[model samples]
Target: MRKLYCLISLLALIAILCTGAYCQSPRTANHQPALAASNDAQRTADAREGQRILMWAGWIIGAFFVACTLYLAVERRRVVASKDAELAGKSQELLIIQEQVNQTNEELMAINANLESIVEERTLKLSKVNCELDMFLYRSSHDLRRPVTTLMGLVEVSKLGFDENTAKYLFSKINDTAVHMDTMLEKFFMINTINHESTEIGEVNFEEILDSVQHSSLVHNYAEQVQFDVVVEPGIRIVADPQLITFILKNLIDNAIVFRCKDGKRQPVIRIEVRPVGNAVGISVHDNGIGIAEANLSEIFTLFYRGSEASKGNGLGLYVVRKAIEKLNGNITVSSRLNEFTCFHITLPPSANVQIQTEAAARPVLITA
Candidate 1:
């Protein structure tokens, strides 16, 4: 635009200079008047033509400058509009990202809350276990020390030179105490194995397992007055850990024999039954025994819990049995009458797809006749 203005100014200056030169040209004193007049007129006509041409050139240049300015304005508006649209798009994207971040934070907070609840529950359980362990230690120490002390005193008395019959009675007492201590220690070892050792799962033959347990119990003095009976469903087969199952059955059966009714009106009897329940296996050990009191039923499975003076047990048998059942993802329920009978029913999942559910330690149940 500046260049166009400068060009118009230069053309005007040249026209003015030409006019002045023409006027200043020396009028020849010797020239004829008519010829000089004619030359002045021609010179004026040429100057007029040149002035018109300069004016037209200036107008054309100005029009071009106007068109260029309008073009530049339109292009600038288009560029500004494009930039505004792009900025708006970026802002929308940022808002979406912010929303997503907020949602994620809320979800994380929920998860943290749930985790805190779970941790609190676990901590309470651990505290209870610790307390139980302390009790176990005290009881174990007392029980173990009493038998040892008794044996030592008996030995010292025998050293004083007793007669034959007296010596024989002393020997018998020593043997009984020693046997009791040995049984207690064996039970402790079995508990340790249940906790640390893994058992293999296989197809178990219940008839064979039951027969073996029955024979072993009889040999071990469980047959003095009680008769054992076994009944298994025909073609009954199960997939499970054989050792664990046998241990459970043995413990229950032994408990039955140890706590049998002593009235002797009719011989005490233990009945074992195995049958299938749905997709799982069901085994029941029922015995006519001096049954558990209702008040003490729930406490039976607790470690070292003794219900009465007649309980000639270390109190680990039922506890170990419960633990074994838990390992197999099974459940046990005890139903008993005060003097009639006591029965333990166990339900076990199939070995192929056993799903272990987290459960608190087992507590026994009592049933009235």
Candidate 2:
């Protein structure tokens, strides 16, 4: 492209030089006869006419060059205008992109704010649920006392079959049993209203809790004939809720006695043990009277589930037990064989920092988020 421009400039310079040389050429001067001079004058007039023609030709050529330069200038201006229009279009597109980005940022901020609001709302809902659960526990505890008192009276009346001396001992045991039930009911309510912030954890004597449960159940006539053999290590102190722990042990012992099969041929036997497992305490209740079927195992702790043609219960006892264990942040597992044996292993944390295990396949873990 540079070479083309240089060639065009060189051609214009050559044309100008040729035109100057033609304009500068001098005319000839010499002596002449009258007729010759006249002829010379005519020749001179003809040469002058030729020079005027050349001058006109030069003007026409100069005009042509001017016209070409103007054409080139107009074309260059058009090119510049087209480039400016293209740049303006690109600038408009960039503005649109910037506006879109700003709008997207605003929307994102709005979404983030909504997410925060949802979190705050959920926290308040959880607080409300905890409050309601505490209220339910108080109501249930108040309601349970009426029926339990009547049951204690009935047990007293049932003692008529025995002698007076035996009756007196039985009444003492019965009264103690009622006291124990009352205590367990109090613990049951505590379990239902468990809060990490509200619970007090200290040295819990597991052996004593178990002994009280056994003695209490005997007073209630639930374990009159069955001999309980507990093999728990004495002086074993676990950091847990004493009331809730006692309630858990009571329910387990009660369930063992209640689910005993009337295998007309054999007597009821139940074995209980509390042992340590990898820094955690495991309390197991084993019964030889009656065992549950595998199919009914998973359904045992559902809200009001019951086994078919097997045992009878209020259906909430085990559910309450499960909730109590959860209050302690512990785990419970059960394995049973029909008409043979059943074992329940309750594993508790050594202290307050117990890992709570979820057992949806076994029983529901009752806890708040």
Candidate 3:
């Protein structure tokens, strides 16, 4: 309807332009010269006037169409610009959403890495727990069961009829069995403690620790019979767990004492030496006692391993020693001569400084029997 109104208005403007052009006549420099012309010349003048009116009307219609075309082009330009702005706004929103997704992906990757680390740590702990459980089973089946069975047998024998001296002998045997069982129970507790406890490193005084072990019940009984020549470096600083080191030393020293030769040929001498070896400490525990055979050298550190058939120990001592040394990140080696002497050499990395002396007799400390 609007387009029809526009078309009608344009036609009315064209008609008005043609009427105005028809009313006005063309004028020349000569005033009445055209009136004096003949009949054919007057007709020619009238034709020229009509042609000029038609040209004027055509020019006016062309100008109106040009204006309408320019207005339509401007409106089209405005619509295109508005659509471009809307498209640009949506594109910007998409970029922002993409950045947010990338940030979320990064956070998820970090969480996955943390979870993996946690799983690895827990797996290690579980594996260690399983190994300790196996050890417990071995002890219950072998060490604990034997001593208990022997104790029960001895108690049953005590009830049998016998003379006074025989009864005394049976009582003594029963007492020894009971003591042995008690010792087994103590060792079981120690093993459990060592298994579960965490190692604590600190400054270690080898001489002080050695002195304390000598006074302890583990070796005090043989103090007079066996001489302990402790030769600790004058100022050796060792960083290790005192309990772990003490356990290792105590077992080795007790083992040396228990395996002393029965022959009364030479005095039992257990010499202990502590010195620096580069970044580690070198320890020598040598005893002049019944020695181990070459065949048992490789198996001495194993659980419940005894080098000699006549070994009175429950066989857990050396096992505990090995475990403690491993915890301290140390290594031990043994060299022995039958019926002569047995020597244990150990190297332990202590996280501290050591005072090394080139001279062997700088400050010699000797304890003789």
Candidate 4:
């Protein structure tokens, strides 16, 4: 547009200069008066023509400038609108990003709070464990040293040259002390083994397992004072760790025997009954024995908790029994009346059924009292 305006201005200036030269020429001044007059008229017409061309050129240039200005204004407005739209879009995106950041911060805060709670819980558990450990150490040391100290005192007394009857009594007391120490050590070892050892799962023959336990008790004279009876569903078998189950049964049976009622005229009876319960097997060791006191029942399973003053127990048998039952995913519950009966009902995992026999001999067998 500028080039076009410049070209029009240059052409208008050339026309004006040509018209002035024609009007002011010296040849025209020397011409006859008629011819000079004629030349003046022609110069006048050419100047008028040049003036009209200049006017048209000015209008054209003005129109061209106006069109360019309007075009530029429209283009600038379009550019501004595009930039505004882009800015608005970017602002929206920034707002979304801010929201996401705020949400992330909230989640982090929640996680931090939960972590604090978890840490507090774990600290309490650790403190409790530490206290229990301290008590265990104190009690275990006392129990362990008592028998040794008694044995040493007895030895010193024997060295003082006692008579034959006194010597015999001292020897018996020393033997009893040694046996007590041995029992305590054996229980301690059993507890350690149960805590550390891992046993495998297998098909367990309850009849065989119960028989073995009964035979062991009999050999140890546990059955001598108590009438033993066993009633089990025939061919009943279970899947569990045999050693662990055996340990649980043996401990319960032994407890029943040891705590039998000595004052009753009738023989103390320990009856074993087994049956199926849902997806599990139930075994109850019911005894007409000196039952546990209600207040002591809850603490019976605690380590080194003794119920009776006459109890020869080191107070680990029930604790070991409970641990062994847990290993097989089983549970034991007790119901008893003081000096009448105590029943330990145990539920074990599902058992395997290998056969179905109906005869009395093949059915659930009862041990003859």
On TM-score, the leading prediction is 1
The TM-score ranking, best first, is 1, 4, 3, 2
Using lDDT as the measure, which candidate wins?
Answer: 1
Kindly list the per-residue Cα lDDT of model 4 for residues 1-369, writing each as its tens digit: 456556655775676576556545553354577687777777787778767766776677677667767766787789999999999999999999999999999999999999999999999979966876687689889998999899989989888898999988998998888877876776777677777887766767777787787777332665566777888777555666777777788888878877888776668888889877665778898989889999988889877788987588778789889888776667899998998889999887643312222223456777654
Model 3 misplaced regions, further than 4 Å: 1-136, 161-163, 352-361
Model 2 residue-pair collision total: 0
lDDT of 1 by residue, 1-369 (tens): 456556655766676576557545654463777787787787687678666766665676566557666766777788889999899999899999999999999999999999998999999978977887798789889889989999999999999999999989999999889888987887777777887887777767666777677677333575556677776666555667788888898889878877888878767888887766776778899998989999988999989888977888789889989988988888999999988989999998765524222222333222211
The RMSD of every model to the true structure, in order and in angstroms, is: 8.0, 10.6, 8.2, 7.4
Number of the candidate with higher TM-score, 1 or 2: 1
- Cα-based lDDT for every prediction: 0.78, 0.69, 0.76, 0.77
* Model 2 TM-score on a 0 to 1 scale: 0.48
Between candidates 1 and 4, the one scoring higher on lDDT is 1
Off by over 4 Å in 1: 1-99, 217-219, 351-369
Which ten-residue region of model 2 has the weakest summed lDDT?
Answer: 360-369
Clashes of each: 0, 0, 0, 0
